[model samples]
Target: MSNSNRTPEEQALMTKAAAVLPGGSLGNLRLDEEHAFVVREGRGSRVIDVSGNEYIDYLLGSGPMVLGHAHPKVIAAATEAMMKGTTFFTQNAYAIELAERIVEAMPCAEQVRFVSSGSEATYNALKVARAFRKREKILKFEGGYHGSHDYSLMSLAPSGNTPFPQPEPSSAGIPRAIQDTVLVAPFNDLNAVEDLLDRYHDELAAVIVEPVQRTIAPQPGFLPGLRELTNRYGVLLVYDEVVTGFRLAYGGAQEYYNAVPDIAAIGKIVGGGFPLAAIVGRREIMESYDQGSVTPDVYVPQSGTLNGNPVAAAAGLATLEVLREPGTYEAYHARAATLRNTLQRLFDEAEIPAQVSGIDMMFDVFFTEHPIVDYRSTLVDKTLNRIFDNTLLDNGILKSPGKLYVGACHSDEDIERTIEVFRLGVAAVRDA
Candidate 1:
């Protein structure tokens, strides 16, 4: 755990933490010391580890810190709201403001319901879709993670070889029977989805997808085609914008594709590093929660203790304010494009079989010469991913263990520094 033989103090802390945690060992400290920057704090693109090692950060808390960690404005607003009131179970002015902001930001969001996390948001969206269609079956793309809920767990594997109209649970503890309620379709395979829908149209409730395909962006027009199919089939189209929201654009992926979903599940950057998420959709679909509904008994009951908690909403509002700023997105995204271009050029010059793909604030480095169009493509190589993992972390610059996200806080200088680190890391792996 410690660099030069573990100091007594370091040993004590490690032992204590290990005792309390299940995965006790520190597995992958990319930096040689293995103590690899624990982290005292972060500001802008740089993070100072507990050991006092500072490095430019591209991990960006998986993708939420678009404005970067602890932006002064976000911190101040959260602080002010915390001072006024951390939470008040009942509705408040702050909540209304946050809702208005989300509604304005999402072109398709006619109504918004706040929740504690992306999982909760997606779960509720699934429920809303089922209820609206008065059906039980939900369709989801392979390898699209829509949170850990049982229904969403089905069909996440890229292999369509799993039986038709159903799939085994991607994770244990999820009942195999739940798979019957989920229909699996490959990403970007419109023909496959059409066939599945034809078979299960009557029972199909919603078809959910991630526009950008996460690690790979969908080929152009793929999203529009999906939208058209869903509409024609009378199935509610749900967009899981958890990672793409605010990062792809202020209005999310929907804006870029010029297509709107019946329901949109949002989280990530909207929370500004806080725990907040929401399901925004058509008014009728969202209004099913209205008190004294015809079948209040049958209405979905989704509530969490921390749903719309004041502090998270305050942070979300502050985050949105920053995102809403004119030209803010342009400045940060330009930086990201530059980084991607530079990195791609570096890989090309090195003659590495690799390609990079992403939009706006998020990108993933894939070590494949072939175009990775979807999850199916991503499954082709395992060792290449391992090579990427080892090399990137071995250097001082830290990124997501897998997918990486750059933040608004990252400057031109930060991008250049990361490029240099990346070149060295790649060269190290090549030599090794």
Candidate 2:
């Protein structure tokens, strides 16, 4: 493997980062030494590295820059808010306004509570569910990623062939007892989920899922079936919309799929590239967050120092305003569809055993002939994927390890350029 062109300054920065940061990364996007490059700044749909090499960025800061990096409105909103003050730890107007916007957009959000990250949001959501339902256990899809909390880490990426309804801890330091609290089921398999619910619904406080499991879109009726099963069994349904929130639609996955959940942990685009997240749900259920409204044992004692940072709320509000503009989704979806379809067509014509698995806005090529419906089905050629991703990086196209996040800021030119790189990536995989 050849290292891409790297300037001395860039090399020095990487060396410094490797010396301090764990595994030379912030534990998000990790590239091999050869392909790794430190990003200096991002504007619109492109990010510039310290080496002054510019790449059309499809990672979009892991799906937060929906309106693209350094958006003028988002910057202005954040800047204006920052000038007033950063954080008061008390209720601020920006946070209240942002919460109102969230309730207005999300179908299930009659009440909202802010957190600093998606992990906190999911953790608190689960806590509230457990409190509301008076149950200790929760059911999550095998591959669904809610966040890095102990409950969310269960069966997130189990290497072993763990059987249904039995969770294997995906991370170390998680207590053995945590395994008993989480039940696992296959994604997109309604029968499996229903069976698990039937057997363990009494113990399950909630059934949490990613509306789009990683890059794989939920099968039609899969979400609705989950809702019905959870309702029938008197278990709460939770949607981890950290990625899909405000990206799939103004109302997130619930609005896009027309299947609402009882509670949702949302982040990513809702934060407008900042570290902000929220747990939104029905008024009755959310009452668990209010200490005065609930019994001492049932009330969730949740508080974060930077939970409702005014600057992040301001940025989030600006992002939502832009998304609400007329014809935004129509135009954005059309552009993404064109790019996704063209890539799939290219791979098919090349006769490569690939499946462009995901919705138009977010997707990646899985180098397998078999259909990608669930987590186990996704165990395909990782080597081929590495080659394809590296090829795109070499050609100035930046994307995440598993998915390509198409942004609203991707211009016609960016799409065209990305498609050309996709062809190169496909050919590289085919030849390999």
Candidate 3:
């Protein structure tokens, strides 16, 4: 598994990164030392490492580079905005235009409040929900990752099997008191959600969830059921569409699923591969952020130095413009569906017990026969999954540890090559 091809210069940089950066990473893509390599640049559907090795990048900057890295339109827009000066504390034209586009696109977004990252967007979404509802507790689905915030960390990756409606902090340093303010429920389970909502609806401000929880698609009626339950209980429904935003559809998961939320946190593709995210919602609920709209006690104060940076907004605008073009999603989804289905067939043909989970546009293989309907079901042979990922990496197909993001930038040739690699990965797992 050692990367013997590492150049002297790349090796030196790796050593330097190890000396300075924690775990030699910026808190993402923690690869083994042997397989890890510093990226030089990305273009179209490929990334070249410092050692001059090229990889077909299915990770796509963790699902933001839908049009691929260094797209001419995105680069030009960002460059023009950068030339005009990057950040301003005051509202800018680009941010305003972007907000208007989001309002038109998202089913739930009557108004928009920009933020710098998905984490900040979700945090503020919950805060505003609590403020608007005048409640304290929030319910989140188990293993539904909204962000790195204290509330999001609850039940993110609990080692032990905790009981229903109870949360186990996934990370250290989260205060024990914070656990009481948060509740956890299994994704795609309507009965569990209804029972919890019935018992704790009075204390709950919002029921936040990912419409597509990680790679697991919602069982039919799940999203609609959640919407009905949240409405019946008088609790705000917040959709964390950071990964699914523009990638799923122009209007995001809400539009694709046809189940609108009271509030939504959108990022990833909306930023066009930049540091930007937003909390968007209906006007009545979003008014919590406006000091003048609400009393001081109920107003939720939120701001960031780089919130709605003009450069990021311009890139997002350009990205959305491309996404709005007719047939864009049709082509993107068809190509990705080809790859996803082909991979599943390959694994099945090889007699490897696997399930290629998630939607066509984004998915990954689980080396298990059990259905991947919820978080607990996702627990399977980690070693086999690692081997499969490494096999793809060795063959110059790069993907995230959990999911493979399919981008519109993937060419016909790129998909064909990846299919070849997928066969190799399937065989590797079969042998293992």
Candidate 4:
């Protein structure tokens, strides 16, 4: 890391975190400068920074922690699990129980294989799709972040006639060959996908899409159209439900939108804020990985030394138990509606070209008069968007800056507080 890139405190942690983890992706905003707010602890919708500043946390760890930081139920479950021996490396009862909850929650998830993170789930889903279809290419939407894996890295530039959409690695160190096997299409542009399918459907194994684009909602019929079109093309459809799973509803956005995919990759709230994820789909496809199958045509070997770890499964089970309650989703919808509407009205009254994009508990504030229907539309007015992000961060409210996520723990008071912050933040940014 550059000296210019690191603050004294950041420099110390960067040295440690980099030595251990890949010095995780830093935001585009100058983190060490104005935007750097080191978190110490959290309770409900508020997080306290190291400096002892309490901020209403809308970032929500980039959309996990939906029950919010250290919910009593989740914490207790984790503590109990920890006390009962952390990792057994053997199948645990909680694993089966959590999988049962997932199967019940996601209408499309018939059989599930658990993993540690969203990236692993999405990556494994790609492998399953290929094995099922016996194809080579994977069609992905531009700017759709499935994971840090090779195939999901291709990003379409904000320009026209994007060609040969091989995986343009989103990060350093990914092999360039990934770009060749991965194809890119603009989100919501079904015709563009058809154009590519004309030449490559036979070779295309799967088409993965975020039912609701992260930070943006899909236009009506967009997701169903994608499902229909992919089914028509014999390409496996994978819905990346990492952000929209329980956050959208008990059954996820696929069920909420009534667009069932061949496979579903889920993360976030499923683990009760623990490190867990899943790739779930039809019985036929998932059964190919069953070890005892005679002459298994597609031998899919999936093992995470920590796959289906007991403690995480226990936490996940506890989280889903609460989410499954009657009217649980209803409360999330009502609260989200209040927050989105209040923010939208604030932008309107301020005469700012800002719009809130979300459904249920997830949303993003785009600083544009026009609606952000897809990734292509997200790039317009980049300057104003940057200004809007900085102003909100400066006002002692914590949002993702890319996409702010509301949670089950975000109370009515939190909504009011966020609206107040948004009003001041919007005005401050507009003037600046």
CA lDDT of every candidate? 0.78, 0.92, 0.93, 0.78
TM-scores for the candidates = 0.92, 0.98, 0.99, 0.91
Model 2 local distance difference test score? 0.92
* Model 1: per-residue Cα lDDT at residue 266: 97
lDDT by residue for model 4 over 1-432, one digit each (tens)?
Answer: 113333467446545654665433354323433456556699888887655667788788878887788888888888998888888778888898889888887888889999999999999999988887878789988878887777666673335335545445566666767767888887878788788877788999999999887777787888888887887878889999998888887888888899999899999888887899999999888876786762455768888878888889889888888887788778878998888888788778878887787664677777777777777677755566556666666666777656778787788887877777777777875686
Comparing 3 and 4 on lDDT, the stronger one: 3
Candidate 1 is scored at a TM of 0.92
Q: What lDDT tens digits, residue by residue, belong to model 2 across residues 262-366?
A: 999999999898999999999999999898898987899899999989999999999999999999999999999999999999988998888999999999888
Per-residue lDDT tens digits of candidate 1, residues 155-264? 66635456555575767798766866887777878888888877888999999888876776877778888888888888889999998888888899999678899999
Candidate 3, residue 91: how far the Cα is off, in Å: 1.5
Q: Rank the candidates by lDDT, best first.
A: 3, 2, 4, 1
Error of 2 at 210 (Å): 0.1
lDDT for model 3 comes to: 0.93
Between candidates 1 and 2, the one scoring higher on lDDT is 2
**TM-score of model 3 relative to the true fold?**
0.99
